[model samples]
Each structure stands twice: as C-alpha cells, then as structure tokens.
Target: MPKPLPLFTGLSAFPLTPADEAGRVDTDALQALLARIIDGKANSIGLLGSTGVYAYLTREERRRAISAAVEAVSGKLPIIAGIGAIRTDAVQALARDAAEAGADALLLAPVSYTPLTEEEAYQHYATVAATTDLPLCIYNNPSTTHFSFSEDLLARLSKIGTIKAVKMPVAKDLAFAAEITSLREKAKEDFAIGYSGDWHAGSALLAGADAWFSVVGGLLPHPAAALTKAALAGNEAETARIYAMFEPLWVLFRAHGSLRVIYAAANLLGLTKARPPRPILPLPDTLLPEIEKAIAALPER
Candidate 1:
C-alpha cells in the first residue's frame, strides 16, 4: 500500500451523537453541534469515537452520521471517522464508507470480542489499510478493547506504510509518557503518536505526543484548543493555567457513574442533547447542580 497520509496533528474533538427522545439519530442536532464546533474554531472533528457510541450504532446510522458531518463541516476542518468493529469485514466497510464520505482519515480500534494473535491483529489492520485509501490512526484504548498493542506489534504496524499514527490511551501516566517517548524514537519519521487520556494531556504533549484527542474537547473546544496551542508553543505557564481550569471536568469524567456527567456537560454547553441512547441512562436530576457548577467554573475564552 502507498504510505498513509501523515498523522494529523493538533487538537481533535470527539463529539457524541445527540439522539432524540424517540431514540433516533437527530440529524438537526448533529448539524447544529458540528456547526458549534466549527464556529468555536476546533482544529478537527472525530465522530463515531467512543464518545459517539460507535459500537451501538448500526452500519447505516454510522454512515449517516459521517455524511451529515461531512456536509456540515464542508471542508472547514478534516474529519477523522472512527471505524471500529469486532469483525474485519465490518471495519473495512466502515473505512471505505468514511473515505467516500470525504473523511481525512480513519481511527481504527482492534477487534473487540476475541483477542487476536499479534499476527492476526496485524493482518486485520493491514486488510482495512489496503481496502481504503484514507489514512489510518491505530486507536489503542486497552481499557475498552481488553487488549493492548504490544510495542513489537506497534513497531510492526508502523512499517505497514498505511499506518500513520497511534492514539495511545494507556491509563498510567508514567507508562503512557514512556510509550510516547519510545514510540517517537523507534517509529518511522512520518508516524506520529497522539495521547487520548485526558489526565495525562499536558505531560504527554511535553513528552512529544504530536497531538491529543480530547473527550473534554467536545464540551469545551475553546479551552481544549487553547491548552493544546499553549503546550505546542512551549508556553507551559499558559498550559498549566488552562489545565487547572479543566481539571474539575476531567475529575468528573473519572469519577464512577459519570458518563452522564460528560453527557450533561456537553448538553450544558449546547454541544448535544443530554440524552444518551437506550441502555445508557441519562444523568440523574440530582447530578445537574454538580455538573452546572463545574461548567460555570470553567474559565472564559
């Protein structure tokens, strides 16, 4: 395969898919949300990521979301479509659809249910990489995928020529930092690594992560973009200032039973409707005050 496009750098936000009370994908809400992000000057938009509830969406729904985003964005910023599935065929289909939808790249996670041998995993990515002309960003969220990509596996994947980036979300701060350092040293010059775990965003940038994919970015694009700019510009003082402001929101995301906290935050900012799809409950009425307090405390852009 031809070499993948260079890894996308800078801040990318993963916005959730807002649904209506009838449990349907709300296109108007989605277009409105994308407009908000673009108007906020977000560097890029990553849809169908974990925040978008990709696993729960049907193939058609996923395609609709990508198409809506592509139309709404209208080339204002590159769209990184999340093409994750437990089956290779499903992933390749999603990738092809995303490329046709005009996405700049695809964020692919390993097969979810069965743990594949390293070689199997390699072939899985290679298959999708070959099937789509879009660049690929290997998403490593072992917490959800139940398996981490070993350094050897990553090193080998980097050589595929179509794998241009890795989004490493190792939970441990030190280990995440070390992996970014080592990956930067060993990977090919064009392959960039991104950090997705919000807690380590500041440190990861300092350690040479090319960019960050922020869940918080969906709720507060201005601050997240500011934080990324500050870090990239070597303005540690500004980075720290923005990070301190974002700390509470990050803490809420970490607290148990807080997916709703995130959803609520997004709603409060008018990024999306507060309701998650069925099976995932909305935030309790009691938590609204706490969510509001955190939002109110956020520093102004």
Candidate 2:
C-alpha cells in the first residue's frame, strides 16, 4: 500500500511508548496504549516524539517501536513517526525505516548538537525528503535543538515537493503569526501548519494553524481530543470548560519541565511505570500530590 498523507486536522497526541523495567520496548503495552487512543477517537498518534524518548533510543529500538505501533494501529488512524538525528545518515536511516515499517508520515527535526547554518539545515531536510517517499513535516523546536527555522528558511523549505507540513513550537506569538502567514503563502497546496507549544495551541489554531501536536493528549487522549474538537467546532463554551479543567496540568508541565513532567503525569495516571531514561532523573516525590490533584480536577468524560 502507498504511504498515507500527513494528517493536519483534529487531535494528534505524541505518546511515550511504554518500555519494560528491563529497558526493552513493551510491544504489547505499546499496542494497548495505541488501541486506547484509537478507540478514544483521536485523529492521529505521533510515535517517537520527544515524550517517546526518541533521542535516548537506538535506531534499532525505534524501528521496533514504530513497527509495533503500525501493527497495533492497523491503519485505524494515521501514525507520524519521529525521525530525528544529529547526522544526515542517521536521519535518513530512521526515515527509511519508518517508511518500511508502514508509518504514514515523518516528523523530522534537527539533531541536537552544534547549530547549523540555515543553508545546512535546509539541505538536511532536502536530503531526507529525497530519501523517503512518505510526506514529511519539519519539527521546529529551538528549546531542544537550539535551532529555529526562520520565516525565510520555512518559506524556502515549503517549496520542496515532499515536505507537506511543519510542527513549530512557537516560542513567541508575534513571530509565530508572521511565520505562519509566510508559510501559508509559500507552502504547497497540501501543506499543513501546526504549533507544538501548549501555551500557544488555542491561539495558534485561532491564528490559522491546521492542527496541534500535544503531549497532554498522550496522557488524557479522550479529554484532549474533546477539547480539540470543541475548539475546531468553535464551541467556545466547551473549549473554555475543558481548557480550564486541563490548564493546571499544563501549568505543571510548563513549570516542572517538558518530557520529565509528561512521564511523571503518565505515571500518576497509571499509564506507565518507566522513568525517564538515563541522565534525566525522575520527578521528585514532592510533586506527586500536586499532579494527582490536577488530574483529579479534570472534567469527567
């Protein structure tokens, strides 16, 4: 079968594929988690996102996780595989692996290392785009990779035939708005635009982002999906209600940290037992009650 196109609407959650205590990927748990998201009617599931600990995983491990996720999904929903590495060869390998493993599209990002010139960054994506037939989405998160795609770069990247979207972690609203407008004018007809910063999700959508990439949705797919639907439907009342309920959790995530806070919240919700991989420590005990309280306050399904 041909690779699926990038999904640009509705809620797409970046889930942390559960791993066993032995550090082996628990395929069964991965499938089960995906099944829950699918059954919950989420629009899409993003595998190997930052929360998936993609950087910590070896190429082989990521292959296994993507294969298991694709098998579990069985085409029920679109799967966007995260393909990011510091080296061009490694990124190409991951993209090739995802295409072979039945992933629908790729969420490509710059590898964490010394920053690249805009020309080098553009070439990095162009090379990957040439390597994989599947549609590609550039991941822009300066906080993690220390590289942000400028409007000029994004406008140029939009001209590539295979690059169909961008996942920008909007660090500044004014800058993001300008970039979005420029991208819309430059991108292909099918190009999708999205923002990853939860703080800016609502505003991003309001400012014309086609969809959102949310880590919160990974923990509470049902509620998050509901909120997105509400937002898209322009149900201000419902959107406000859900946002209010989930705002506390978002606040904690922003305050504590990104991947770390997400893993802690997942553990609190009984989703996984695995801690953040080496070099990154687990959440402190002092934060448990606060997390629990925030979760408990979420509106009932």
Candidate 3:
C-alpha cells in the first residue's frame, strides 16, 4: 500500500482573492468565499494561489488575505499560502509573511522575468525552505512563471526538509500514472504529489495522485470535493459521472482560461461582484448564458 499522505493532500480549494482596483483585498468577500469551501467539505484551502492572484497583490494585501482566511477557517482546515514572486528576497519575505499570518503551508513558484536555470531554481527553493518551518509545496506552473522544474531539480528539492509537496502542471499526454510513478521513484518518501489542471483532476486522483490542487474547487467546491471523493476511492463510474457534469465548464475553461471562466462563473452564481484585476478583463456578458448552462450541469447538492 502507498504511504499515508501528508498535510497538503486531498482536494485543496484555491479561492479568488477579491480585491478592488487599488488592490486592497476585500476581507469580507474573501471570508464569504472561504465559508462556502469549508461548508462544501474541501480538505484544505489554497489561498493566494494563481486563482487568488498572488502575483498581482501587494505584500500587505497578501498578509491581510492570509490573516482573514486564518480567522475564517479557525483551525477547521489547513491553509496553503502562495508566496510566488520574481525576486528571491521577495519570495522569502512573502514566505515569512505567510508563516506569520498563520498559514499552514507555503506554495512557491519560480517567478522570474528572465528564465531561471535549474541550479538557480534549486537554490531558490532551498533558501526559501530554510526561511520558514512551514512545509513548502513546489508550484511548478511554467506557463505563468516562465520556469520549469526539471525532474532532477525536483528530485533535488524534494530532499529539502521543509519541502514536503509539489503542485504539478498536467503532463503533456495526460498520462498521470506514468508521471506520478516517475516522480515518486526519486522523491523522498511521503513527499506528496498533486496536480493543478482542473480538467485533469479526476484522472490524476484516480492514478494515485495524493492531492488535487484544484482551481475549480475554489468556487464550486461541493461538486469538486464530491468528484475528488469518488476518484480517490477508485470508483471510476461515479467519478466519470461527476466528471461529465464538469465537462461543459471544462470546455469553457479550455476556451477562456480557468481564471476568467471562474471569475465569470462566480459572478453568475451571485457569489461575488468583484472582477479579476485590471488588465485581466472579465468575460463578456455574452458568455453568461453558457456559463449558467454549464453550472446547471452539476448535482446542486
């Protein structure tokens, strides 16, 4: 049998960080979002993640978001805070801020304007790992961060004491079993492996992935958690049934990107009036009907 997973495992919901044009986090709106995720029975909260617009917020705002989430969660679930930044010192400071604000774990992406070498990435993670006792999850999001962690680099970083997990992007072929097995072969024992592509979540979980670092789960946690439960239990029929309900939204996510689609879905659900940060336009009103139709596909429980 597989070794027991650690704290960052399971359906970790990544909520949007509601903020105004000035980038100040709307703490009340954020707390309301958290309430829904907690009520939906998600295993953990991934705050200030890519969905949460961590790269767009000021450090002060990030700290406020963490504190508000900690208060809202109140020990109910683990809070994994995203601390990605272009500069090493900035990431270190953000990691410190996350720890001070009661975050349960740290998620770091190798954010850089210029491409980072594998050695640079490894040292960056090593330095940040030493800065906080909080367990760290490597956020291997090359599309946004412009840096990819090599398997060798990943194996190297996994040996770091505080680096306990990795949030992987989807494999090119979606062959999650081969990918997980390959990564696990060199990773430290109990180093939890999870995937973040919302569309591939069910397949990843069914393939023995330890967690689903989900984007859709942030808003639609009920169905996402339900799908997670079914997949992790190895119930393919039920997983496929629940996954089909998500197919419509997945189509939209593929077409318009999960960030914009989710923002649209949240508004359509009347969950929030806030839009994505400026320069990231909200989906046009024309898509609302389709979004509504997709949301209607879920179980509504």
Give TM per candidate.
0.93, 0.93, 0.98
Question: Which portions of model 1 miss their true places by more than 4 Å?
Answer: 1-7, 21-23, 171-177
TM-score, predicted candidate 2 vs. hidden true structure: 0.93
Best by TM-score: 3
Number of backbone-clashing residue pairs for each candidate, in the order shown: 0, 0, 0
> How many residue pairs in model 1 have overlapping backbones?
0
Candidate 3 lDDT, 214-252, residue by residue in tens: 998999899999999999999999999999999999999
In model 3, where is the ten-residue run with the lowest total lDDT? 1-10
lDDT of candidates 1 onward, in order: 0.78, 0.81, 0.92
Q: What ordering of candidates by TM-score runs from best to worst?
A: 3, 2, 1
In the range 1-301, model 2's lDDT, one tens digit per residue, is 3222448566788888777544578777678778778877788888998878788788888999999999889999999999999999999999999999999999988875787999999999999999988888888888788897887788789779888778888646447567677777766666788878765576666566678898877667878788787777767677777788888888888888768787787787776787888788889989989888887887535
Better-scoring candidate (TM-score), 2 or 3: 3
Work out candidate 1's RMSD over C-alphas.
Answer: 2.5
